[model samples]
Target: MPAIVGIAQVVSVGSSGVFHIGDVFTINPISTAKTFAGAGSFITGRGISVYNESSLTYTVDDEVMDQGINFNL
Candidate 1:
């Protein structure tokens, strides 16, 4: 299980398409790409679909530490 530490406003370079509850995500700050979290990826948080409004933007419940770590989704 993952801890919900805080809320975050994540946005991709462009439209992120539709997001659903429990969707895994990671942030690529360099490219500003908010893509799905995968093996060995640093998991940022899970999706809260109700707040997903635009294709490029969405909200999430953060689970990573301030220092960051690799967590697979």
Candidate 2:
């Protein structure tokens, strides 16, 4: 069974862009750029937009892993 072990909130610096459920984003270094999850980049968690806010902020679920990687989801 899958459960939410952790939660994260990301804020957009330049443009909030479009985000959807299951959209993954990087957490480390804390970036607001909209970079796709499996796009040869480090991923921290999966996006979980619950409400429609205008502050350019998003909620994500932390990914479970034994070790962190530099790229890839």
Candidate 3:
């Protein structure tokens, strides 16, 4: 089962931590997590040093993980 949310809760990552949305912006390690907000839930993730999506011609401006990873669906 999955949960639903509205877009009204979509807030920017302002907290400081490894699992926080803001931390991923700078550290870019590579991982994946269950993204949620007033707009519901989403499986968010990003690539890492071992995996580069950019080189594959896939541009990911926003990533939920600090490294190369994906939230299992």
**Most lDDT-accurate candidate:** 1
Query: TM-scores, in order shown?
Result: 0.16, 0.16, 0.15
Candidate 2 lDDT trough over 10 residues, lowest sum: 30-39
Q: How big is the positional error of residue 2 in model 3, measured in Å on the Cα after superposition? A: 0.6
Native-to-model Cα distance after best TM-score fit, residue 16 in candidate 2, in Å? 6.2
Q: What are the per-residue Cα lDDT tens digits for candidate 1 across 1-73?
A: 5555566566753453443335357643322234654343453567623433444433474957343333421
- Please give the lDDT score for candidate 3: 0.40
Ranking by lDDT: 1, 2, 3
Cα lDDT over the full model 2 = 0.43
How far off is residue 10 in model 3, in Å? 3.2
Compared to the true structure, candidate 1 yields what TM-score?
0.16
> RMSDs, each prediction?
18.2, 18.3, 17.8
lDDT of 3 by residue, 1-73 (tens): 3445454554564343233332232454244454333321233567423433443333444856455434321
Report the C-alpha lDDT of model 2 over 1-73, residue by residue, as the tens digit.
3355456566764343453335455434322333334332353567833443443433463756434344532
